[model samples]
Target chain A: MELDPKRYAGKRLLRREIPLSTTALREALQHQYFKQIPTLRKEKNILYCNRCNATQPHLQNINCQNCGSTHLYCRNCIQMGRVSYCEFFYEWAGPNPDWHIHNNPCAWEGELTKHQQIAADAIDQTMKQNGKLLVHAVCGAGKTEMLFQGIATSLQQGKRICLATPRADVVRELLPRFQQAFPTVTVQALYGGSPDKTGDGQLILATTHQLLRFYHAFDVLIIDEIDAFPFHADPMLHVASEKAKKQTCASIFLTATPRQKEKRQIAAKTLPHVFVPVRFHGQPLPVPASKLCFGLHKQLRKGTLPKGLLRWLHNRRNPTRQVLVFLPTVVLADRLQEEAIEVLLPFTQKILPKRETETLIRTVHAADKDREAKVQAFRNRETAIILTTTILERGVTFPSVDVAILDAAHDVFDEAALVQIAGRAGRSPADPTGEVVFFHEGRSDAMDKAVRAIQVMNRRAKRL
Target chain B: MNLCVGCGEAYTSRPSWSTFFWPERISLLCKDCEGSFHRLKDSGCPSCMKQIGSSICSDCLKWEKTSYQGVLEKNVSLYSYEPFMQDYIARWKYRGDYVLGKVFEVEFQKLYYQHFQDTKYEVVPIPLSAERMAERGFNQAGELAAFTRAKRKDVLGRKHGEKQSKRSRLHRLTAENPFQLLSEPPQYAVLIDDIYTTGTTLRHAAQVLQENGTDFVAAFTLIRG
Candidate 1:
C-alpha cells in the first residue's frame, strides 16, 4: 500500500490519482521489500489507546467514529453462564448443507446477530490489548464466538497459544475443531505422556500440568473451564502459567458460571466484559428434576444398581435420545458400570466401558481426558449411556443428552455441580431439549442450590 | 571413615580422587570389604543386590535397577550382603513406612541441633533417585526427610533428580548424575541417601550437588553398609 510516497509527498494525494510506471514501479517495489530499512531497531510495535490505558492491548479501531473517546472496552465480555460453547465461524457456509451438525454450534454458523458481532469485535479488542480477558455470557447464550476474534487476533499477533481446559475430555474433543480453525499453525494436543519437545508448535492445547514447562510461551492463553479442575485447584499449575505467560500476555477465560472473584472484577469495572443473554441456537438449557432415590449411593457401594434406578433407566431408555449417568465418584462409576453390563448384557453384543476417559486414567486426580472422552462417546452415539463422577457436572455439552445423576445427594453434587450436570442436556440446536434427573438418596443443600440456579438461569434466558 | 553399614567396612572419610579412583574408585573400599565384595561378585551381575559372587555381582555391576552392565559403581556390604541386609530393608520399606519417618525425623533433629548449631544444611533426603521413586511411589530418603524434623530448616531434599534405581551403579557413576537442589543450593550440604551399602548413590549426589555449588555434602544414611 505504501509505494513511493515521495511522488505524492509534495502534492495532495487521492486514492485513485496515484499512477505507476512499469519501469519505476519495479524499483520502488524492491525498495519496499529490501531497501527501506530503518537503522534504529524499531521498538516492539505498541499502540496506545487512552480509554483502555497503555497497559491494555490497544484496540485496532479505538474510540469508534461514533464514540470518539478511548473508554471503549466492552463490559459484556466477562459474564459467566450455566454452560460453555465454542463459536465456529467459517468463510464457506452454503457449500456444505450439513455443516450445522455440531450440537454446541459456534458463532460462525447460525444467525450472526448484531450483538454477537459486537461481542466478537470486543474480543478482538481484548486480544489487541494483549492480556487477561473474561467472557460474561449467560446460560444458553453462545459464549464460544466471543473467543474466535481474540484467539485469531492473538495468533495473528505472532503468539503461541494453548487452550487449557480442566476437562481433558474437552481438550480431546477440541483438538479436531481447533485444528480445523487454525490449520496453518501447528497445534499439539498435549496432556499426559506428552512426548518431549518434538518441536515447539505455534499452538499447544494442553492440560494445566502440561503447561508447567511453559510460561509466557503463548501470545494468547485461552483458559476454558478456568474455574474448574486442577487449574483452579493447584498453585503449581498457576505458577507454571505465570512463568509461561509473556509479560502483558493475552489471557481469555471462558466459564459458564462466573465465580465470585470474576464477579468482583466485573462489578468493580476493571475488566472488559461481554454478555450474550440468549443462546445463538435460540433455546434455553434444560431444567433437571430433583428427587431422593433412597439410598442410591449405598446400592452403588454394594456393587448393585438400585431397583428404582433400574426402573428409571428403563423409563429413560428409548432409541430416540441418549442418556448420561452422572455419579459423584469413580469408585461408584465402576460399580454402576458393572451393574449396567450385568443388566444390559442380554440385549447388546458389546458393552464398551467409557473409552476416552481422562478422569479414569489417573488414580490420583480426576481423569479429565477420560471424562471428556465419555461425553464425546455419548455425542458420537456409540455409547447409549456414559457414567461419570462430578467432574462431568459442568462445562461440557452434548445435544440430545438426557442426564441422570445417581446419588445426586452426595456432597459432590453441590448446587453449582447440580446446575452444571443438568445444563449438559438440551445443548443441541436440532433437538434443543432433553431431560435431566437428580436421583439421590435425599436432596442435599447442593441439590437445592443446583435446582434453584438452573431455574434462575432458565428464567434469565427467557427474559432475554 | 567411610564405614559400610552392611558389615561396618570403614575406609577413609575423605574424597579419594587419585588417578586410580578419579576414572574409577574401587580403592575407596576397605581391604576387607573390597575383598568380600569382589569375592561375592559373579558374571554379569553388577548390583550387589544381584551378585551371586561369580565374577561381578549380577545386580550391582549390571546397572541401577535397569540398564545392561551399567551399574554406575560397586558397593561393599559389611554384613551378610543378602540375608541380613534383606531383613532391615523390608522393615524400612514396609513396616517402617511411617515409623521410620519418626526415626529419621528424630535423628535429623538431634544430629542437626547438637552438632552444627552455627552452620546450616539443606538436608537433601537421598533421592531413591527417579527410578526408585517411580517404582516405589515415594522415595525412601525423601519420605524420611519429610518426616525428619530439625531446627532452622530450609526447604531441602530434591525437588528433582535423575532416575537412580532405573540405571545401574556404573552408569550413574559414569553418566552425569541427576540430583537437583530445590532451595538455593547451600555452600555446605548434607545428602541423606537411604543406606550407605555402596557409597555409589551418595557419591553421585555429592558430585552432582557440588557441581551445582553445594559444598561439604556430608552424605548421611541410617546404615553405612
Candidate 2:
C-alpha cells in the first residue's frame, strides 16, 4: 500500500526502500502479474515486406508502417519518382522516373534514384488525398529522409504532426536530424527519460508513453518501428495511438517485419501499397550458413558442451568483432554464460574477452535502460559476447555478425522471430555472409520455415 | 441622529417634490451598503468567462434557458470583486480559511439559500471536471458546499463539456447541460456556482441536472446579489 502524504500533513514525507523476500515477490507475481488484461481481438490482415521479399499476415489492429495502415495488405507499388533495384523489383515494382516533378520525403537529398522518387511521390499523393499512408521500406532504406518532405508539407499546411518509435535508440538517432530540419519548430524527443513537449513543436518524436497526455492533438501521425516491442504486444498503447489522431487526420506506418495479416490484405487488393524493393545503397541481401546442433539437453544434463561448439566459441573471441548469444529465458542465459566461461576462457590468451576471460558473456533485456549503450559497446568490439533476448530483433542492425540460438525448438522461436534473428546477420555490405547456428536437440517447423523464408528472399533478390 | 447621515445625504423617508429634484431627493445609497450592492454582480458570459456590458456574451448567441423562471441572481463570492473579492477567494480556497467559506455560506443562507428547502435541493457540487480535479487537487465548490451543509449527491458528473476558458461567450448555452446522473433523476434542484459573475457553469449544470429528473431549478453561490 502506498503511504498517503496528506494524512500526515505536518510530518515530512520520507519514502523508505522496502526489502522483500523472493517468496513474497513470487506470491505478488502470481496475483498481480498473472491477472489477464482484457484481450480486444481484431481482424487479422496481411502486409508485404520487400526487404525480406515475403508477404506475411498478422493482427490488423497493429500499427501500420506505411501511411499508418493498421489494416494492411502485402501488394505495394512505388509511384511518382522511383529508382528500381533488381532485388526490390523481384518483390514489388517502383514507378517510372520523372525529373521535373517534386514530392515529400525525397528519397535522396542530393541524388534521387527512380524508386526513391517513386516512394516520395506516392506519399505526396496520399497526403494530398488526406488518406492514411504506410511506407514499409527496408531497414537501411533511408526511411527517415523519405519522411522529411512529407513532414515539411504537412507543417507548411498548418498541420500538427508527431512521429513515435518504440525504441529510444532509434529516437536518439533521429532527434538530431529532426532538429536540424525544423530548427524553429519545437522538436522534442520523448523516451523513458522525459516528458511530452509535442505542443512546443509542430513536429515531435516521442515514445508511446509520451503519447498518453494527448487526445486528438495531431493532424498527421507517423509511427516508426510499428511492430516493435510493446506497441505490437500491448493494447493500451494501441488505443492511445488511435486516440491521438484527429478525426480527419491521416496516419503513416513504417516497419521491416510486417506481421502476417498485412500480407493477406495486400494479396486481397483492398488496401493500396507502395514498395521500395532495394536498399538505398542497393546491396544484395545477406545469406547465412545454418548448422544443426543436436542433443543439447543430453549435453547439458551431462554438464558438458559439444567439442565442436566449444572449439567454435574459442575461435570467435576476437578483438574486432564480438559475438551475441540470444536465449529464451534469463535462467538458461545466466547458466550458459557461466558454463561457457569455465570451458573456453582458460584455453585462450585473453582468458575473458574484455570483462572476464573465463566467463565473457552478460545477459541484457529490454527492462534495463543501459541496453542500448551496452549493445553499442558490443558493436564497437569491446566485449567478447553479449547475451540478449528478442530485444535486438528488428530495429538493431549489426554488420557481419554471427548469431546462435540455444533452443531453436522452444515455443518463442517462431517464424517471425527466427527471420528477425537471421536479419541481424549480414547487415553491412562488407559482411554479407555469416554463420547462423540453431543449437537444439531437435529441428522444429518454425526453424525450418525461417530458413526457407530467408532462402526465398535471397533467391528472389539474386534472380532480379 | 446626525450619525445616521451617510456621506453627506440626509436620511429621510420622503421629500417634497421640489427636494426630489436634487441630490437630497435621491434614495439613501450608503457607501458600505452600496459597495455591497455593487459587489452583487451578474455581468459575465459563462462560456468565455468574459465581462460583457450586458447579460448575453458574444460567443453564446443562445442562453441555457432553465425550466424554472427568473429568480434574480448575482455573484455570491465571499467579497466584492477587485478590492474585496480577491482576498475572500484566496482565504476561502487556499490559506486554510475555513471561516471565510463558512461565513460566506452562512450569509448565503440569509439571501439566496432561504428560497429552497432541503426537498428542493437537487444539490450539485460545482463539478471540477475530472481533468481539472487532477491538476488543482481538490474542488473549491465542494469545499464551499461542505461549509454550507449543501447536499453532496453524485449526480452531476461532467458530460463532455468544453472548458470555460477555451469557449467564446456566445458558445455558452444557458440550456446546454453537462452534468450527468449516477442514479435515477431527482425531482427538483438548484445548481451551485462558487463565483456566478457569468452564469455558464450554473446554466450548464442546471441543464444537465434538470434533464435527468429535476422539475424546478435555480442557482445559489456563497454571495450572489
lDDT of each: 0.52, 0.55
Give the alpha carbon lDDT tens digit for every residue of A106-213 in model 1. Answer: 223434566567777877787787746687655445565556655666665555566777666666667777667656666778776555332146667877656544
**Model 2 residue A90 lDDT score:** 13
RMSD of 2: 27.9
In model 1, state the lDDT of residue A145. Answer: 52
DockQ of each: 0.03, 0.01
Tens-digit lDDT string for candidate 2 (B128-196): 677555323346677556555655565667755566645666675343656666676556665566765
lDDT of 1: 0.52
Q: Chain B of model 2: TM-score?
A: 0.55
Highest lDDT among the candidates is held by which one? 2
Per-chain TM-score of chain A in candidate 1 equals 0.67
Model 2 off-target regions past 4 Å? A1-114, A180-184, A195-199, A298-308, A311-320, A342-360, B1-225
Q: How many residue pairs clash in each candidate?
A: 103, 68
Quality of candidate 2's docking, in CAPRI categories? incorrect
